[model samples]
Target: MSEKAMTDIRNDPAAATRHDIALSIDKVRGVLEALRFGSITLTVHDARVVQIDVTEKTRLHA
Candidate 1:
């Protein structure tokens, strides 16, 4: 199978405040592109994405 570019955002915030700080698709795409190739883990707390970690992939394909 061919590899396809994709982004997965896991919304772990509370139900009520989930819609308060919504990220646009374009913004998200730009963020991912800026990081180049790697893995990013979004850390969320209190209905907000507080941190981002860009780590290199250890294996050939992960």
Candidate 2:
């Protein structure tokens, strides 16, 4: 995406609040909710979320 195209934000507050944030949030929430042992890594680019990485660890009980 072009610099202008990427930084283009000409709309209301709701418009500014797009799925980018919402979806990322939902994903983060989901990971946290179902995570018992693991880590969540967020990748950001140009102030935007570019990726979401989840590392889940399985625990064995004695």
Candidate 1 global lDDT: 0.54
7 Cα displacement, candidate 1 (Å)? 33
Question: How big is the positional error of residue 16 in model 2, measured in Å on the Cα after superposition?
Answer: 3.1
Error of 2 at 23 (Å): 2.2
- List TM-score per model, in order: 0.41, 0.62
How many pairs in model 2 have backbone atoms within 3 A of each other, for residues 3 or more apart or on separate chains, i.e. clashes?
0
C-alpha lDDT (0 to 100) for residue 45 of candidate 1: 88
lDDT of each: 0.54, 0.77
Candidate 2 displacement at residue 34 in angstroms: 1.8
On lDDT, the leading prediction is 2
Best by TM-score: 2
lDDT by residue (31-50, candidate 1, tens digit) is: 78877567777777865666
- Output the lDDT of residue 9, model 2: 42
lDDT per residue for candidate 2 within 1-62, as digits (tens), equals 45554455443444445736877888889889999999999999866688989899999999
- Poorly placed runs, candidate 1 (over 4 Å): 1-20, 23-27, 57-62
